[model samples]
Target: MKTEHRIRVLMVAAENGALPAAKVGGMGDVLRDLAPELAKAQVQADQIMPAYGRFHRHPHASQLARLTVPFGGRHEIVTLYQLANPAHPESRLFLLDHPLFSNAGDGVIYHCNDPEPYASDASKFALFCAAVAVALCQRHLSRPEVLHLHDWHAALLTVLRAFDPRYQPLQALRCVYSIHNLAHQGTRPFRNSHSSFGRWFPELAASLTDAQTRRIEDPSYPQCLNPMRAAINLADKVHLVSPSYASEVLQPSDHRHGIWGGEGLEQDLNRRHQQGGLCGILNGLVYPDTPAPPQSFEALLNAMHTTLLGWQGHGTHLRNVDFIAHTRLQLWQQAKRPPPSMLLTTVARLTEQKVAILCHRLDNGDTVLETLLRRFKQRQPQGLYVCLGSGNHTIEAELQRVAAHHDNFLFLNGYQEQLSAQLYRQGQLFMMPSSFEPCGISQLMAMREGQPCLVHAVGGLRDTVVDNQTGYWFEGDSLEQQGLALLARFDELLEAFGSDDWQRVAANAKEQRFGWQSPCRLYRHSLYLE
Candidate 1:
């Protein structure tokens, strides 16, 4: 294919096929949406991901090639698979398959042990980077004019391209590295693998002494030399998931809490930008069907209206207080362990960043549920607490136990795409107490579904949720405040559902359109493709 005939773009993503059959985090959602959208825009885009066992592969998928990827004085044979995009069957996708990396029991990628199947994860990715360069050099497939790297796992490709002469000839090819979440930088001890930089920078192994290696693995910012940071230093342009979030990282300003483990790294990031590197690219969701609210929201609203209004055909009144009350009651009844008179939904990872623990955890080390349950126990609590998604086994287990003990609480351990859409529609308000967020899609989807978001004012959350307008925005990092705010608004929302004010907010949220068309255009502009 002629270079000009197709806007050849290759996206290197770490979380694309992650969790296979299970929809895990936001990154996978991005990959799922982006490639197909870009293809629709006439951009010939393809994704490269590890062939995970969890992935349901298509039979016609072609095995592209086989090569031994060197890692820490050892070589692992990797098989490359090619398939047209299932989402947009016309678009292409490349899967890098390695027996050692993915051929574990269930074909999941978590095969780390001993020398760590992926222990040299950084090195493993380094091999992938080298392979990408080699592939580009050989011109065995489509020549990508833009190499898009997502998060830190793929950042190494930018570093390798900085020096790989084979790819240097494609000087027109611009490197775009996106910081999905700067906190999870892929940094580890650089084992002296022959096919690795040890062959080029022999002193690399010496530099990473025992002490230094240990420090890098530390979760602390000082101990980490994130490859994402290195990519920022090398790539022509660095992008964040959202414009507002882009602004947040520029200043953590004590407001960011919980989820922000690598706090000061943004300071260093700003310094790098001063030298001319970083930029913000707001994350966008694909509106594949109808560009309308998911059916789940409509169904939930109908039930609420019918229960509260008594005279309802459909809750035509924008903010019908009675309708909201009815809705809450219905939801409460459906909740496994309903609360006294209110039901709140929080669907996110059960981590501190997600504020799952903070909101649910009690001073006695039990959970907020115990406190709420205790208060409502005498009243046969009308409220329900439903949690969807998984993280931190301890947190997940605790949440499950709470659900089991309390009829008001319901815990869904894994992610369900349709269920997520339903939650956005059915839930009165979406809660995200993340210490810091890089433009969360859940909140955006909630708003679009006419469900208000009650989020902490940090990163993307700060940018999207308008305080008192769209939903609620808490300034502090405290989950207690978040839970309180939801409770405080509960009665008002129910009493004045048809109120013009609340309706305006829901309408505004519904109108807030985020699609890949504009973002893809930005990519074209950034790369000067037009």
Candidate 2:
């Protein structure tokens, strides 16, 4: 059978970093994969992102065009450069460059050099959104039938096109706004909008004068631009990154699943859900073509096993228990023992939302790592855990403290991309205990490398992992309970992982498909098919 007819769709995002070439992660990964995949399926797919001032400092990015982008009551000169897809050169990437985004000095992308919000983030993204809007309105760029915007950074495009008469050319265009994470709504008060709307966004602001004239009604802005709010109200459709997360965040306010209430935007989301405009689509993982798969499965397992054997003083527990187990026993007698044979790897930032889940406590007075340690200690004499990432100094300090007391635990407190890749290849197991994950790429990457994951059954993990098949899932309301459940699931994995069983499971895990085929269909149907 042939693929369905495809429509031209343009995607706008803030920082378009995808993997090796790197920008703000997750969302970048999605667009990089999805755009090319759509192109293959016959969609005339193209993307636009800001060319931060420093984008070309290190690597060679292809050039497309250089032009000024008008926004926020002023005109800024933006060079539109091109990045050709290695696989599909027909697919287009227009990078809009500006000094602020480039410098790491004025404003960086949403990744925020720090976990906390930068003081000028609202202004930076506002400028980006406005630039994209004006570019389309002025007809300086060709308008696609559909415009796909990612997260809050690109939300205002839909807002501008919907409300501003000058953007009339884009008024009829279908828009898709995807919310990767609801926690960040890009909210700063109305007083923070363009200082000179009369001079800069003259016609655009005037279009907002009459409440009855605007398609999306919101009196909350000009006081504060909740880009997300406008996107939800104006975009043709909105979606989350995973089905489970979509369901959880859609429940009524008093419901347990709706505890966080989509960062208190549930009312709008509930309406969108009722109108069939809100849902979730699990993200696709594009396995790199550059690094070909290993020749044999045994080669992969042997590599991991060799890494295990090379662990410095980490011991193993066995009934025979004569060698390393003996060493662990000696250490135990001196109260310096650690987990004996278990090895788990984590490659997430040390923030509460991610890696810190290993050690952070919930209101229930229970911490994931603390509870996991209790259960793990009961099963083994000493285990090795390697964590790689950095962000949030408090979490970093806590992880260091845990490493200091546990001889087998090592924390590498910064990002090393190649080292991260190596760890994924050799790690016996991968762990992701995120508090709330929109969509996680690490677990998918680990599985692609034939390593099973241990993730909480939430968000993307729920959609990705098949319990007892590709990997195991543990879910609970509180972090402590989740940790206990994680330990329980791990024990089950340990039981099922015999010499032959493990190979079968690893193969099954690798067999899991993580491409854009399914999700792109959803987008095509929602945004273009009508």
Candidate 3:
């Protein structure tokens, strides 16, 4: 008899499957990319999630099992769906289907209802934890050696395993709790967990009460222990998204002003560090299966020019524009008019972290964009600009106004993955001027499409974007300086790359791999898997 060798990893996350259905930021993209890579890497990784309403059911998404999950003194019979791949047949994803929780349009994870009563919100995730425990006990799948949990949404698994013998056998199980962001700690009243678990684990009531009292009186005892805090407190190993973010959280800082953490979370971090906790890993992305290096500036510009001029072929145009209208449709059409003579794109959530505000001309309420906008209005504009994504309503409106005023500017209000890939392939350059970033996927994806990144030199951007080699990097966050620098770099690229010198840089950018191969290897090593 031959023994089969496979490492089963149960990856617990709030969101997966598709984008925009429930994604607020990069975490959705991370899981989507990582899941496929895990399969390719030969790890039998299965994802466990609440079947938010957004999840479109496939034929294979069958009702695998059923169980009465306890929630707030009531038991709800939750149907668990097993979405299996037809090719693999055996590989499956477990989805907990509960109308109370899963009815979020497409069955996806929603950010916590902070002020609203998702009356059954806690119960919803609690049921997920219970389902995982039951799933293990029933042997529906092979026992996983690792229960990898992401963010506070799934932190309860760590907490439950620590106290409940029903989960104690898994105590020997190695748990890796990934903290995507530290800000959204799932802090509920300690009494909620106490009361919720009272019937299940009566012995913890006294401890919970004491903790609650201390939490109330101190106001600093980490009120209610959200997933981020709980996972850090309980997991055998803890990991942050990036190395720099790991350092940043320990020493808190004000937005763009300076480091403010003289005595913030430093003490807490030191205490944890002393106790043999805390690690950081840079997030990785799956490189697209497309080869799109620029042969020459003229070729690149010609393709872009065609796309701008409503030309749809010659490898420069998108598959379709209707799909790209997920953001701001009217604005997208306006910007796509007259076909841009030149095409430059910056697609990201309009947030301060992205430093998109810097792109706006602040002087005379006329931004650096004013010049770009003016160029678009000219009979022969230098380029057409396409900015996709939604964030700060003020910024969205401002960009919309800029697009409305200019003939060659398109602004999308939200995310559309296919359109983004199309734009990535078509655009000449992908610009990101984030003030600070942990590990940006956009730049890596852009590079994969043979589009060089133009970014401010900071954080992960600095780590990825090589100056004058792979892409352009600006010094400061100043709008005028960065804008001119970006334009200058692009023009220089045009002049230099009109020859063959650009090929080396393009090849270098393309060759710089950001795939799961190396990162997954690093993760395996970190977890003592050779």
Candidate 4:
């Protein structure tokens, strides 16, 4: 009897949830869930990421090999470690380590405050890509039929595979590139800077032809190299996180029309789409066989208060957001009244992509959020709206100012997983008003907990959420229009709250299933084996 062979695949990414403390966003969640699902499909998946100076400290991590990698005009030694993954033993996890991996700080997956945007991170990931290429050349890890690169951080591998003769062996492997967010393209100068591509790969830069340079150069910035563009152009297949987002990127971005398309890469993406090399697949979530018991409204408040107190201890004095949250939590506890008639919750990173519309200035000289608070107070005086997130100091300040003025709104300026899960379970409505979303996990998680969502009709939200059925969605022709539409939709939902229609939507939401089985089947037949 002959044994059947499983197709081998190697995934290079910046974040993986399989390893403790390795996740920062949705990409990590996808990696954690996707690997195990692929394993069940008889696809042997191996995941690799930079150790970020933290994973080697894992008790189960053991050094696999030491390789000398040529990078940045010098040869440097990199340590490769194999990490034990008891949760998904069928899939292997590896991490590469060097001092450069921790240039920003130990255990920091991303350095957002770099002197130049993406300067530190780009340099760090460039070295990581080169080291991975070297590991492949030395046969330190088994070769795979496919090289899967996630986001811009892992995109440099495609560059080295295409340009370097020593890495020519990688040219034979099919390459799949996943674009998680198109807005963040890791573009840096090609030459005349310490962190430029010429500085990192001097010999390769010198030997490149005009056509090769053009293929890798930033479309908008002629002197810069764009890893996102290079991978989109050179990879065997380009994948967006959701089907709606894949189609959205084919059209040019129009801010005036409130459409966030391809940022500036629509031309390249369109070219890929025309050539039949681009695809969009929705991400999957891991669902428990039996759902956990839902917590009471008061229990949710207690959890939020406890989490707030813990965060308060981190600083000598309370920040405005923290102070506001503490005061509101105390007030709610003292009232000893029934939970609010209408409860709303939101959990997201406070970036422009996520919160810009909420902060939009209206014709009345007030922000959209202020308007929403005023309307909610008038419609449901006993309602409470809780928002949990922390990012972008400017946005944080704006939210803090709104919280101070609005008695019904509570702004928690930090994230806690326990508190977030509670928010998902206790709220009557989940709000996600992203200007553009590739694919969102928060809405899925909220729906899974039997809470209907009020989301912007874009990207994954459009795919997973059915308007007025599973949840409610709104759209408009401009930002101000969209903001107004969001307010209108909120009013409509408020009018119908606790009615048969609302309960039906909630029931439909809970019944919605976005499991990994279907998506992994697509991964096997469409992405990997295709």
Compute the lDDT of residue 269 as modeled in candidate 3.
52
Worst lDDT run of 10 residues, candidate 3, spans 319-328
Please give, for residues 1-530, the per-residue lDDT of candidate 4 as tens digits.
Answer: 87546889999999998876688888998988877788877788898999999987888889999989999889999999987554587778899999999987889898877878899999999999999899988899899999999999999999999999999999989999999999888999999998899999999999999999999999889899999999999899999999999998988888876779988899999999999899999999988888789678888888888898898786898777887888888887898978988999999988988998999998989998999999999999999999999888899999999999998999999888888888998889999999999999999999999999999999999999999899999998789999999999999988999999999999999999999887877777788877
CA lDDT of each candidate?
0.61, 0.66, 0.61, 0.90
True lDDT of residue 465, candidate 1: 79
**Which candidate should be chosen as best, given lDDT against the real structure?**
4
Mind giving the per-residue lDDT tens digits that candidate 1 earns over 291-333?
Answer: 5444533464444344334434445664332333444445655
Instruction: Kindly report which residue stretches of model 2 are placed more than 4 angstroms away from their true locations once superposed.
Output: 1-6, 18-20, 56-72, 106-108, 111-118, 192-223, 252-261, 288-341, 362-366, 374-382, 491-504
Deviation from native of the Cα of residue 89 in model 1, angstroms: 3.0
Number of the top candidate by TM-score?
4
Instruction: Name the runs in model 1 displaced over 4 angstroms.
Output: 1-6, 17-23, 40-42, 53-57, 103-124, 163-172, 191-225, 252-262, 288-343, 356-380, 477-504, 527-530
Tens-place lDDT per residue, model 3, 135-169, is: 66667656888888887678778766775555677
When sorted by TM-score, best at the front, the candidate numbers are: 4, 2, 1, 3
lDDT value for model 4: 0.90
Per-prediction RMSD in angstroms?
9.0, 7.5, 6.9, 1.7
